[model samples]
Target chain A: MDTVHYLLEGFGTALLPINILFAFIGVLIGTAVGVLPGIGPMSGVALLIPVTASMTGGMDPAAAATSSIILLAGVYYGAMYGGSTTSILLNTPGESSSVVTTLDGYQLARQGRAGSALAIAAIGSFCAGIVSLIGLALLAKPLSEVALKFGPAEYFSLMLLGLAAVSGLAGNSMTKAGIMTIFGLLLSTIGLDNVSGVARFTYNIPALYGGLEFLTVAVGLFALGEVFKTILHKESHDGNLAKVGKILPSKQELKESSGPIARGSLLGFFVGVLPGAGATLASFFSYIMEKKISKTPEKFGKGTIAGVAAPESANNAASGGAMIPLLTLGIPGSGTTAILMGALIMYNIQPGPLLFQDHPGVAWGLIASMFIGNVMLLILNMPLVKVFAKIIETPPKYLIPIIIAISVFGVYAVQVNTFDLILLIICGLAGYYLASNDFPLAPLVLGLVLGPMIENNMRRALTASNGDFMVFLEKPISLAFIVIAVLWIVIPFVLKLKGKKVLINEEA
Target chain B: MSKTFDRYASFIFFIVGMAFMIESGRISHSAYGSNVGPNVFPFLLGLILGLLSIKLFIETMKYQNERKEKEALDYKKFLIILVAAILYALLLEPLGYIISTFLFLLVGFQTIEKGGWVKTVLISASFSFGVYYLFAEVLKGTLPGLPAWFSS
Candidate 1:
């Protein structure tokens, strides 16, 4: 009952003309970002933060944060919907999460059922979005309530668990991921020390005083890094696009996909709620599950509608599910969510248990906006998918340079200094070389975002215990979190030792 | 993965870790009321990073030597664009937003693919002026306008 009242107020906030316009613009741009191959959701969101910041400059701080977040979250999920279009039409996954959709999506397109495949994907995404939103609304209150009881010790341990979980499943090499995570943490400690107001490792450089701007590093790493890769590799997509015939799926196709959509949504929601497993894993699992249970499993790779439906739904649902931990626990489970968290922090709004109590307008407003955003996505995607498909034809020549321009413009707008611009370029180079060598950039970004909070909590807990480190282990909840963190890292290493191939979440 | 790159990266990371460990010591040891100081966290993280880099170094040694096909990279193009981007950043404030942005985009488009001069000029012009007008004029944001010499 209480949730209902909050949600009603949230609806009132989301329905405001400005907020509605922001949501509309967010999903619209999100679909375009998804349609474009090179820009993933992380880069897309990072690139837009400065733009949104500037656009919302006139609003009151709280309203500004709400509108910016509403738009950004829309982009995050809208990308999931747009990703399937490219996979089906061009045989190219727009983002990593949509990789599995290419398996049957292209085959269905080849059979001239491209329209049905697209319709099913849109419908599945819509259903999954609603399912995950329901789950978020239901779980948000209780989860935050549980988190409210956590002391500094528990928070320190919980953050550690988040770090370990991300590093455990990040990339091909856990060691490399660990190195990146530690490097990010070290980088975070470079600026003024928050605890004692002592400047550490600044070397008297005024730019280093604030530490590395999360926006600068993120834009450099994801956006400019991808651009550099494209330039160096001479990557150009010239695939022939599949033609769209009918705009709707048949009754048989719809009926067959309903079960997969439902099951995928539930499965993906659970996977998403976990710390490390994300949309990529959820989609992969759903695809395999569908194959395993199908009576005619052999038909899966040969253009089964279920193949297109399940993974699409699962990935969308997983993105929705990823929000649970961020909103409630203040821990971002994926790279994109990490960026989102940074955006919220930039607005002086910390997302956590206190987020609901302190700024229900931002939290619930964001939640309510997502419901409207999903509807906008379904409506926009159904008729305008062909228009989005045209986006694939955008020449890499123009796109690449414009992306570079946007990166510079964004960083300059926010930082207004040459130092950050130089740092941005350097980070872009390092990001290219490091990522090319299989060092996952996601954990690095995650570590940078989470590092200060982890240190603060650690110090606070130690302070409470008179400098005894055992305070972390003395508390039952803290001890459990520590044990879980250890196992999260160790279990993956053990699985590799046993010669079993462990699935990694590449998108995260 | 390039074994050479990994080996060099591991070594570089080790040096970075060492630098952090050495530098963190200069920070004051203890805060006024707390036993833990600002220096403690970075020092510990530096130690862990050093250990992880060593592990990465050892892991690189265990990799079996397998010659992989190396794709030809467009280093020339990348270098050109990179230099252009750096110049864009350096000259942005001095040359003002429109001119610097316009010149950068033109160079970028041309470098990526030759020809399409009219299209390139139009796009570059529109983008620079459009963003300047929208952000600075309408949104009331700060961006260096046309150069002082030109305006005067």
Candidate 2:
């Protein structure tokens, strides 16, 4: 009942003309970028930040915040909507969250059901969006309180658990996953110290003081690196990518997808609310879960609608779910949310236990905008997908160089610092290395954002405890997280040893 | 699987980390509490990285299986992209934002794409101008500039 009242308040703010307009614009641009390969929500937001900042004065600060949140949410869904297009048409996923879609989506394209594949993906995402939003509305406050009780050790332990889970679940050797995670941690340690306020690895260059920007690393590794690797290969195809089939899913497809969509929404919301996790992992887990449960598991990765529906829905739901932690507590559940946190801080609106009480307008207004934005995304993306498809066919030659120019200029524009440009290049090089080695970039990014918080919390905790380490164990919430962390490592190892035969079978 | 690669990564990172530790150690701030200093985290992180490299070395040695050797690293397209990026980085200061970006994008597109001169030029110009107008005029960002002529 309280949730209903708060949400109604949020809706009242969202219904304002300016908020609605921004929500529409956010979904519009989000769909456009989401449809294109090599662009993710992070880049979309980074590219538009300067633009979004321009609109700050036109609306109230609270309303303007809703616009930004709506835009980001739009990008999130737009990316989900557009993700399957490439997977079905080109056998490529625009983002990691879309990888599952590529399996059945590509197969569906091969079977000349491209239109049906896309329609189902869109529909699944819409369902997930609504369900996740409801979950967010209900769970955000309670979870925030839970998040508030965590100290530095608990946060670091949570990160450790995240790294382990990523390695355990990543589609590679455990040793390889461990190495990649460690490598990311090392990367995060670069630049000035967050707690000590001392420069660490600037190498006498002033620009390095800020450390490597995640945007530079992400864009270089995912977008530019992809172009570099694929430039020479001529992907031989048999025909014009399967022409749009029926624009709506068949009754059979709908029946197949309904169950996966529901399960995915629930799973995605839970993952999103957990700190250090995000939509990418949610989608991956949803696909694996669906595959594990399906009666006709063999049909997976071969045009099964459920295979596409599960992950697509999960990823979208996770996007909303992640906001729960970020808004209620100051903790970010994922890397994208971490960036959003940075944006919020830039606006001087600190999000924490008091955020709701201090600024209900910003909190509820942003929440309301997300609800409206999801509808905007569904309406905008489902019909105009062909236009986005055309964007996919755009030659890389034109896009790649422009991307480079923008990245170089964008970093420079922030401060007119020649040194920052150098730092960006160095980060780009590091990104290229990490990508070539199949390291998960998200952990390193999250570490960069959370490192200071963890460090400060540790200092504060120790000061309160007078050097006693037992403070971590004394707190029920922290102890619970520690137990979870311990189980995270042990469960995976035990499962691996016991299921060696199962692993072999899956590999084959 | 080569010692060379592991050694190379470790050696580079170790040197970088040590340099950071030394610099931060000289700073007047503490790291954790009154006893712990700011250099503690960097030094610890560096030490762990060094140890991890040694472990990586041992693991690489255990993989004696003669996997298929990879092709020589392609440095052609990579070089073009790198050079273009370097040029953009270098030229960004003197020429200001719009003109420098437009010229850089033009050359970079042609160098990489090879034959799309007209499309590259137009697209490059439009992209630079659009970013400039959006950031500078619309956003009121203090975008660096030379003269008003570069605006067109």
Candidate 3:
């Protein structure tokens, strides 16, 4: 593709020795934070941003911004690698996105295959990351064109489809998913109502006027929630330290994983590009795809290499895919990308349709750095797997307090609001309970992030159409997405009632 | 145990969602006069969520009827963690970041984890100082300072 040439320019900038080193450091720190369980990319980046900003002294603002972007990407992927280690070793998922990894990952660890599990996760992620980066290089421009064609109705329908797709999140019932999605929309309403400027649910708090903080919700749900859950269970794993079994995949395992990884990457990327759907959905769909296609379908949840490869590959690929909408349009496809959007704003760079013409360096540099950052993550993760897993075993007694304190400090640093600190705790507790009974946190995060955009766009569409009620249905792309959303809700119920168990029968 | 948790949670969701719809309805009176208001979408969403929650509660009961009752939950342990979180939030402002954080870790480790004093103290102290340095010094994040006696 002609666009690949542009990516090469980006690669040149990203490969500069200084940029490479920063990318490596970002991945290393991201992995360490991820291993701690509950510390997500947002908090990870927020804490690190201060240091990066201070140290980038003499670099041009553009190059400095690129460095930070590369660093952030490193943390994003590095967290993925770190998240899996904890999920596999301790059954505690570091992020909501890693929840599915825990189902088979910890089971494999219990079966004395922790080394193999960790190795496959790293290797699978590498393969997926490389392929997705290539896909991004080749596909971004065309995909952006596809994105530009979408009208407000289409965007709204796409979000609805994304919301409905949550019904299939592993372990959550359809109704619970529905309720969770609604809960997210409600949280999104806490700030000012964009059209009227009337406060919907602020209850007089000024912090509430800006609405729920994304970092607060993310840190609380992933990290504090984990802490609360850990304390509740009051259970600790007796370190059996699974005997150093084979770390490398067997030939058969390698053959098995290749098909799953390839398919998962494609499936995950498309799903990731959907508005509001994210890596979590991509992981779910990828797992379902593997089970659907597997010849020996019964080996799925029983420490199967294919099972791990599918979701792991999908999520990494989806990370690349999620960037498409955010970069091409002003639309954010996932919670993480929403945060990335905020970072772009802080750097005074606007990412939208004209971004390519306005600031090609920022766009291309970000895409190019993803490729280098993935490699950096792979190298950073493998050697540190054992050491990282040890941190997971660190007792919560000491761990939780430190994380909570950091979370508080991190929030306070952003706007220096004491109220946000309090809000963080309240939201964290609510998130903890919601997660405990299987209310997936992703939708809430997604809704809160995308809520304003959805509302603003809908109003614009309505006004543009002169109060035509059917304008949402009038656009072709919009209608297609609405139909897809309807199918997402309807199809699953039909499948469940027919006893068409889509879940692969795993070997016990 | 799983079914009980599922059912109870859904029932609570049902009630809260209903409450939200009613509350939105009450506040949306003026918007209703204007034919639409800020609360319109939320009101409808709340109603949909309420209905779904009730349906899910029923489904959870059905599942429970089909399966065996789960073992009793270990609520005692969960309560300790909950209390610790509540305490951390309460004390963070009054006690200052470093001192409160160190004490919070000590209590959680010593009481909840039942770790030894030496282990608890060392871990707690290191963690408090590590975060303080990372955020305050390295990252330039604004953190609450300790009393004059403690800073020296």
Candidate 4:
């Protein structure tokens, strides 16, 4: 009942004309980002952070944070819907989460069922979006309430669990992921110390005082890094697009998809709640589940509507589910959400148990705006599907340079300094080289974002326990979290040793 | 994964870790009302990283010497764009936003694929001017403008 009242108030915040406009623009741009294989949601959100910051420069701080977050979160989920478009039409997934969709979606397109596959994807995404929102609303208060009781020891342990979970599942090798994570944490320590006010790595450099800017590093690694990759290893996306013979799914197709959509929404939401497992993992699992439960499992890869519907629904739901930790526990479950968390931190709006208490407007408004954004995507995608399909034809010659230009403009406009710009380019080069060598970028980002917080809690806990390291084990909840963190890493290792296939997220 | 690259990365990371560990030794040991200080976390993390890098280096030895595939890299095009971008960054303040952005875009678009002069110039000008107009004029955001001599 309290949730209902809060949601209604949330609708009040979300319905403001300005908020609605932000949501519309966010989804619109999100679909385009998803359509462009060069960028994923992580870079998409990172690139827009500065642009949105400047755009909302006029508003009060609270409203500015609310509106921009609504837009960014809209981008996160909207990408899920757009990812399916490429899979069905071009036999290319716009993002990694849609990789499974290509197996059946391209098959469907070959049979002139491209329209059906697309419509089903949109419909499934819409349903999953709604389902996840409801789940978010119901579980948010309880989860945060539970989190509020956690002391510094518990928090330090919990954050460790989060890091371990992500690193364990991030890349092919745990060693590389651990190395990247440690490097990020080390990087985070460069700035002025939050508590002691002593500089660690400045060496008297003025720009180093603020430490390496998260915005600069993220934009360089994900956005410019992608641009450099395209310039060098050029992808030839000149394949013929499947023709759209119909605009809507047939009645039989809808009936075939309804069950898969429901199951996927439920499964994806739970998977999404777990740390480190993101939309890509959710979609893969949902697809496998659908095949297992199907009456004729053999039809899965042969233009079946269930294959198209299940994964699309699952990915969208997982994105929504990913928000649960960010909003409640203040821990980002994946790379995209980590960027989103960074955006929130920029606004001085710490997302955690107190987020609901301190700023109901930002939290609830964001939740309600997602509902509206999902509806906007459905209406916009259905009618303008072909128009968006044309965006795929946007020439690389113009697109590549323009993206580079925007990234430069964005970082410059915010930092207003040449140092960050130079750093951005360097990070971009390193990003390209490292990513190509099977190193996972996500855990490094996750580590960077969580580093200061984890350190703060660890120091606080240690101080309280008089520098006793056993305090982590003394607290029951902290002990449990540490045990789980250990199991999360060890179980994966044991499985790998047994030659069992351990599912890894390629680009979370 | 390239075995050589992995080996070098691990070696480099090990050095970085050791540097952090040794450098942290210079900081104060404790802060007010607490025994733990800022240096503790970084030192611990640096030590962990040193061990992890060794583990990573050891893991690389298990790799088969896979034949290297000579990828057809567009090094000429990439270097051009990279240098252009670095120049744009260095020149952004001195030359101002519009001039630097316009020149960068012009170079970038042409270098990406030559022979779309009219479209490229028009786009570069409009984008540079349009963005400057929107961010500075409309949004009232700060940006370096044309020099007084140039404006006159």
**Quick one: best DockQ, which candidate?**
1
Q: Residue by residue across A296-344, what tens digits does model 1's lDDT show?
A: 9999888999999999999999999999999999999999999999999
Relative to the true structure, candidate 2 reaches a TM of 0.86
Error of 4 at A200 (Å): 1.6
| Model-by-model DockQ, in order | 0.91, 0.43, 0.37, 0.89
Going through the candidates in order, state the TM-score of chain A alone for each one: 0.99, 0.83, 0.80, 0.99
TM-score of each: 0.99, 0.86, 0.80, 0.99
Query: Model 4 TM-score?
Result: 0.99
**lDDT, candidates in the order shown:** 0.94, 0.67, 0.70, 0.93
Q: Flag clash pairs in model 2.
A: B31-B37, B31-B38
CAPRI-style class, candidate 4: high
Extract clashing residue pairs from model 1. Answer: none
Clashing pairs in 3: A38-A223, A154-A478, A232-B78, A298-A505, B1-B70
Residue-wise lDDT of candidate 3 within A236-347, one digit each (tens)? 6555444435576678777878888888888877767665566776787788878888887887788787778888888778777877777877656555665666566556
Best by lDDT: 1
i-RMS of candidate 2: 3.8
State the lDDT of candidate 2 residue by residue for B57-151, as single tens digits: 56557555665567566567667777777777877767777788888887777766688678777887788888888777877776666655565
lDDT of 2 by residue, A1-508 (tens): 8777888988988888877887788777776666666567766665555456555645666656666666656665666667767777777776667877888888888888888888878888888889878887777777666756666667655545544554454433444444545545556556676666666555676656776655455444444444454442322223355566667778998999999999998998888776545777788789999999999999998789888889888988888887876788766655567667656654667776567777777787888778788777677666876777777776666766777776776566554667666656666666556545544444455555555555556666665776576878887767776788677556666877787521210000
Clash pairs detected, candidate 4 = none
